[model samples]
Target: MNLTSAAMIGRINPEALGASTLGLALYNTCLMFGIGLTAAISPLVARERGSGAVATTDAIRRLVHAGFWNNIIVVIPVWCLLWEAAPVLRLLGQESRLADEAASYLHVMQWSLLPALIYLVLRSLLAALERPRWAVVTGVGAVVLNFVLNWLLIDGHAGLPALGLLGSGLATFLSNLFMAGALSVAVAVDPRFRKLRLFQGLGRVPWRACATLWRLGAPIGIGIVLEVGMFTAATALVGHYDPVSLPAHAIALQVASFTFMVPLGIAQAATVRVAGAAKRAASARAGWVALMLGLGVALASAVVLVTVPEPIIGLFIDPSEPGAQAVTRAAALLLGIAGIFQLADAAQVVLGGMLRGLQDTRMPMLIAMFSYWGVGLPLAFVLVINNATTGVWIGLTAGLFTVALLLLGRWWVFSSGGRRPPIA
Candidate 1:
């Protein structure tokens, strides 16, 4: 959906593309917090189901319940933050026109946060239960729906108003709503899940369970925020350049993020598989297999990015446009840098999930903070200050590589007969 929106908006104008990119970057920085919190649900549920206790279903139910409450608690402040995105962006040194345009996109898009988080909770539950088929189905459906809506609404097809950037935001909001609803229906009706009554006790607060969630989830949230915040900061720095730079950065980052979903899925599967393993050997095996698969996917994605940069860039913006040559050229260079970092990106994310299955989040969180803020952002600043746009991505590559190596070392320690990290 993001790719589609970028493509359509890019065709309209570079300014629109930059505005949408900045708005979405801010939105995603906030979204990662919710995602990290909900992520605790998968390992918790998976471990519980593997425990062989008769109350496993009840335990999973409590965790799911707590996750929904967590989402509610997290969304309120995030919504408030997004409401003032324009002011915030302006404070970050964004141009006034770009800030206002981005804020307009956020105004309509912020409502998607709650539903998107809810969908994550449900999807995590389904994945942990080994019943992710429906969630995948619902996700694919939502993407298709988002594309159709983007077509009809973004350009005012079917006699509708040409809402442009706002239309893209509305399409995303509606698609997320559909995803939450469709997944809810899938869980409610499936015979495999109905007995669990995952949605039955929304009004009741499970204080203890909620506490457990925060205890385990907060570091994950902070870690994700650190990592995503680095990217967001980079986006802001890029925004300080010509309009072409921001859209080019957006296009390159979007392509990287698109390829990342593959490894991310493998990582999620690794979390469930490792958490469910009855023996240390089984857990180690699961982690290794996931890493290999993630690396393989990363290699293929990197090859595509390196070899076919122009075609891919063309997908997002027209090179034939008078002002698009600079954007396309810049995006191609960034994509090449993105390709070089794909392996590091895959390794770190997959390793993070592997450690997460052991419920080892705090150390990873600290590592992310140091690698991104300490290493990546500072380097990016130095490079960008020298007027090197591609150097900005090189800094990102360095950061991802640092995190990957550090995370790999941590995973090795855990898999080599070291003491298990406390769940907290």
Candidate 2:
């Protein structure tokens, strides 16, 4: 799902104009909810240490084992989603050929779900255990694999069939597999990780851990829904005006995805650092780590995007056609707004991470709902339907700000209150 939108935004023809884009948007909506499931895993694993019910290491080990299997459990829904992709594409008004193409793309991509989920478990366990550098290596490797295969498969290079959209899907599946296999191998070989036998068996911890995971994750997942949904909805709303506007919005979205990695990475790191600090009763350090990296990187990323919006956008847009001109204008509008959003995006994610560190997800979800649905969506509608692309930017920027403010308040309240102090 992560790669799905990127592929669509990067490669699909906007001029072709079909329901595929809208279908993809709906798929993304569901995928966003699935990601929320991880929020449940991290805090549950982290809290085991603070509660004195389980030693930190043991709790983390159990989480790794349980999480690996929990991923397997989610595969059922992944399969169903893939099976439904074609029908959904048809209903969205996609052309026959495009729907066929998308169905194949979705089918191959679904196989990645289990592996991606496995990698997610590894990431959460590693982060909650304060070993996030594990993520840096594995994640980079997976991304590289995705890109290389995208070129090969999409272009039909290296004796591989040129599957186009389906090829991109294949690339994504392979990338997830690479990450899961590499991480598993690394863990198996490392004496520290080996002792935990993270992959050995869940034995009896599955139900308890799954319950705990849902409890922590449901809210975080809802929060992601609101966040990702806001961007997706903006594009959809803009699409009402004309074909080019929405695709241009998608281009800007792709660009933002690349830049957003920083805060998202920092946020994950913050979640781990803060969770660890909270488990150790180190409130000051937790708050500092969560905000400091988030602040520095957010500013840096936003500035880069703002300063060279054209060049950054050029990478994703073909510069030689009339289509290019339309996209360039729309991309510029979206990027300009995105530059402003970087601040709030950074603040909100880091703020949420800080809350994750403190084992609070419920409030953040509420904040996201109010900010995106209550505020951003309505504002976007008024402006977008009125053909105010610039106003769409204003609405999204405001949403990000609202999220940041509310999330920051929650972080301070939870961390300062010390609701999750370590076992004394």
Candidate 3:
């Protein structure tokens, strides 16, 4: 839905698209911290569920409780970050007008963060319980509703106020609110969930369990922040180039993000299934299966991106529009870069998910930091001097490739019975 909105905004004005893109990049960077906490829930629940102990039901309930509180607590700081978006963007050297516009979008979008986190926690709950149909239903419904809301509010249809980018932000907030409410109702009314008593106790905070969740989740959160922060930094760097650079970067990123969603789903499933597997059965085999699945999807997507870059890029901007050729060309080139890195991207994410299944996060977080900031950012800074926006994409590709290799090596050792941390 965000990509769709960005496309629409890009057609209306490239600057709006750029501003919205920067806003969303920043939003996701901050949002991932809270999401990281919730991301732990699925594996934790899967491990408990794998025990096949009726007693583990109690552990599941406690984990769900912890997830809720963790999301709530983390969102507070995220909100503060959103509130200060303008100042932060300024410090990052974004154009003043673009920074102000992005900040306006963030101000409205921030209201959705808490609700979105709540929805994510519930989605994690459902994933752990192996009941994903409800999540699918709610997600589809939210996306459809967002489409209508953005159309009506962004351009002022049927006496509605035309809120431009802010309308898109409002649509996000409303759709998220709807998802949280609908999912809550679905969980509350479903007999399957009721049988497990997932929400039985709400009053107790269970500080110990929460602390354990934080201990396990902090690295996941930090890893996500570091990884996405690299892209955010790339967006900032790209913004300093010609006007077309930011919009083109945003368009290519949207396409890459869509491709990523496929592997991300596989990765999530890999985490749950692998985590649920008994220690005796948890080996490189499971990770390899997941990696192959993700790589297959990535390969297919890369073919589409490479063969039809113009049509794909055409989706976000009119080729016939004056001055749009440059943006389209730039985006197409970035998509080609995205295509080259798809395999590396798929391998790294799936491996990370497999490691999460093994209750490992801290080391992966360090690996990400080393690959992204220590390696990617510096490379991008140097290359951007001559390559502009393309430099950032190349740097990111290198980082992902590095992480993929390192993570594969780590998993190889773990599967070989080398020294490894105990599963959380």
Candidate 4:
């Protein structure tokens, strides 16, 4: 939704759109570690709820507490990165002007980091507890809020000053802030979650539990960095080509990301379901079911992109807009490539979620590094130099395919062996 809003901004002002995308890319990547770290909450909470070792509520409370504290622990460094976003992008060879624009946006967006991470924990907890509807409700609300705020702030409606791209960042920050507070309150007041007493013993650190979370989750975070970084790197490569290339790449990527939300939601469901299924019937079979369901939706999305790429691209920017032809053309090309690899992307994401449910992060991390950096990045570099934007996305498709295959193979092996708990 945020990206779509930014894409709309691109229609009015391309530079702001480019800056917003770059700024958001930097923001998301910087928060990757924290997001990954907190992801342990869902699987861990699910496993504990399944085990009945201690009281379910007690176990969940501790896990939630530990996850919350871990966020606090990680927020400082994440904040530092957000604060220094422009310098980091500049260091990575991003255009100085674009970097400065991204930095200006990040300056305001950084304020949301703590709240956003908290929101993540809340969502993870809700999903793990099978109270995902609450999270969904909150998410829908946030998207709505984001859209309204973007309209009001970005374009300076109702007697407000037009803040442009910076307005987009501020909208993101405020919407996230609203989400965190709303979800937290919802959990606090709800009878189901109230028993967990999440805030009751907030002072207790649970250092060992947190360390375990870090142990399991940091790899997930690293894996995220590896995967997401490859795309960000691709964006950087595109940014070097020409002004049109960056927004074009951003538009195509955003469209692909928008489609990805379907699989992403399914993947999240898969994680919760698989984790809950733990030692039950073939974990592999359960994983396959999840993978197939996600793939089905992805295939449908692929058909849409393949058959009518122009309309999808048009959603971001009007074909009739001046200077939009080049962007539309470029985005159309990327979307077609995105269509070809859509299933692979869906498969990998669902598989990753299933693996996370299995608490099998290390191997996946290794595979992602090997697939994305080892195969994907090198290919992208060579291809971008030779083929420009087209080459980069082709490389992306290759990386996604490779990762999906390796992940499927690993799940096949592990699920074949035993009902044993997943390795940490």
Candidate 5:
């Protein structure tokens, strides 16, 4: 999508930027919003206080059942909204021929949105069920499918007429459909999912338990939004920069997402571990569970990027492609800051998850607001936008570093001596 946007933005007028940006941001948001909300299961499982010994399988079954239905809330709106893409894009301020083309892409892409949501729900279910290997396999398959279909459809291969951006959207939608079906089938046939029939319908979840999830998951959702928005905002702010720079950031941004996938997994593990420990009533262990995971991944992400920077980054940007230099510069920027950011980046994300495990989100949200908005936003405005790539990266780093310290410290205070009882 980033690459697509980069390619399109060059010829479009300035009016095309807002709808294009919002469409990409919010449409992709359907999945992130679900994944963030679905994270409730791990912490909820940790908090189970039932006196009678429930089988672990039963606990997991209930968790998956609860998670699947909850995700529907976000998924339903995503595809539905696509029906109005033309009007919506108009509302977002797209004018001229780009508006019509953007609308076509948006509408076509909507069909794929719900399937991605399904993938997120399934992935979260696996995490709640304690099965990362399955999750990983399913993810790899989705990536491969998306890539192949993208090539075949977008360029009109195999005697099919080329569909352009709209075709790309169709390819994306089909790939997601393929992935969602596969993941759902895997769950349906799995001994674990079958035992619970969690997919049968919503399982029995206590009212308090439902409330507990919203309590934990809501701010985590908002925090996820703010954090993602912060960077996406960087992308947006850059939209106001040179037209070519926007696409440059787009290519760089996509590459960064893949690199950040490592920390993304580590953060998931931390959220799960903390929840598991909380279930066991081990606060100290919960903290360490998260800390250890972050540290373990920190070296791996930084070390590899630090060691062989160019080859890794260069793969994303082909020099022969027009405007590829922008991609190269963006990739280099990500590479240069790899070490400076990931440790704190890892620490911050893990700690945020740790807080989610403890059902403590308000504090983290406040810290995020301060770090990203109060400090990060203004700093970025001064350095990056004003100077155009001069100090924007520095401010972005400053914001991330602030987030790491504040959230980890927040975790420390509670884990050390706070009155909060360990979840049963």
Candidate 6:
């Protein structure tokens, strides 16, 4: 969806793309809150199912119910923030026009947050149950739906208004709504998932279950916010630096984010696989295998980013356009830097997932805080003062590497020789 938006908006102008990118960054930062909180569903469900506990099915259903409530709780404040995004961006030192444009994007795009987070909760449940086929199908369909909507709405095809960035935002909103509804139907109809009765009692709060989710999920949510907030902060900082840098950074980051989804999926799978393991050695083996798979995919992604950045950048912006040369050049450089950190980024996320399966989140949250803020943000500030956009990415790379190393060490300590953390 971002790629589609960026490509179409870039055709309008670099400034438009920059504004939209900043809006997206802001929206995603807010989204991390819901994502982090609901992430507990998978690990909790997986562990319960693996434990052979009585009424495990009921427990898992209650977790999913709590997850939906949690989503509603998180989205309320996020919507408020996004509603005032223009002022917030201006306060962050963004240009007034850019901030307003970004805010307009957010006003419409923010509506997608609830549905998107709900989809995540459902997807996580499906993944935990190992009934992920429908979720996958729904996601692919949503992407295609988003693309067609983008083409029609962004440029006003089929007599539609040329909504530009607003159109992109609307497309996202509708696609997410579709995703959430489609997945719900899938869960309802599929014989395997229907028995779970995931949506049976929407009104029940399940206070104990909700409290348990918060206790375990808060650190995970906070850790994600810290990490995503760092990147969002970077985007804002780059936007403050120069016009071209914002769009450039957005394009590069989009490409990197697209690739990161590979390892992200592996990491989620790792969480489920490790959580389901019956023994310590089995868990250790699952973690290591997931890590290896993630590293291999990251390496392949890095090579592509390094080898053919221009072509990739071209996909988002017109290289032949006179105004785009600077943006293209800057994005290409940033893409290379992004490539350098692929392994670190992949390792950190995959390891983080493994640790989540172990229900070891609080320390990882501190590690993320220290790595991204204590280290990455400060270094980026120093470097950006000297090296412009390049400095910011270099600092980001350093932070990812630091977090990855720390997380790996943490994983080793758990896998080595110690009493395993109790499953919640």
Deviation in Å, model 2, residue 285 alpha carbon: 4.0
lDDT to native, each model:
0.89, 0.69, 0.86, 0.83, 0.63, 0.88
Off by over 4 Å in 6: 419-424
Model 1, residue 227: what's the lDDT?
A: 87
Is candidate 1 or 5 superior in lDDT? 1
Q: Could you give candidate 3's per-residue lDDT for residues 147-191 as a string of tens digits? A: 888888889998999999899999989999999899988988898
Instruction: Give the least accurate 10-residue stretch of model 6, judged by summed lDDT.
Output: 415-424
* Model 5 C-alpha lDDT per residue in residues 1-424, reported as the tens digit of each score: 3443333332232233333444565465555666667776665654453223464665566556556556665667766776666665455433435446556677877777667766776787677557766767776776676666666665677988876566656766787787778888887798856675656545454455455556667777777777776775665456545434544444445545555666667666666666556243475576667677776777677777667766754544445666566555655665566556777777788777777766677778778888988887789888875666435556667888899999877777777766663331
| Clash count in backbone of candidate 3 | 0
Q: How close is candidate 6 to the true structure, as a TM-score?
A: 0.98
Query: How close is every model to the real structure, measured as TM-score?
Result: 0.98, 0.87, 0.96, 0.95, 0.82, 0.98
**Model 4, global lDDT:** 0.83
User: Any residue pairs clashing in model 5, and if so which?
Assistant: none
Clashes of 4: 0
Write down the lDDT that model 2 would get: 0.69
The candidate with the higher lDDT, 2 or 5, is 2
Candidate that scores best on lDDT: 1
Clashing pairs for predicted structure model 2, backbone only: 36-221, 40-216, 40-217
Residue 71 shift from truth in candidate 5, angstroms: 2.8
Q: lDDT, candidate 1, residue 391?
A: 71
Q: Model 5 lDDT vs. the true structure?
A: 0.63
Question: Residue 323's C-alpha lDDT in candidate 2?
Answer: 73
Selected candidate, larger lDDT, 1 vs 4: 1
Candidate no. 2 TM-score: 0.87
| Cα deviation of 6, candidate 2, in Å | 4.1
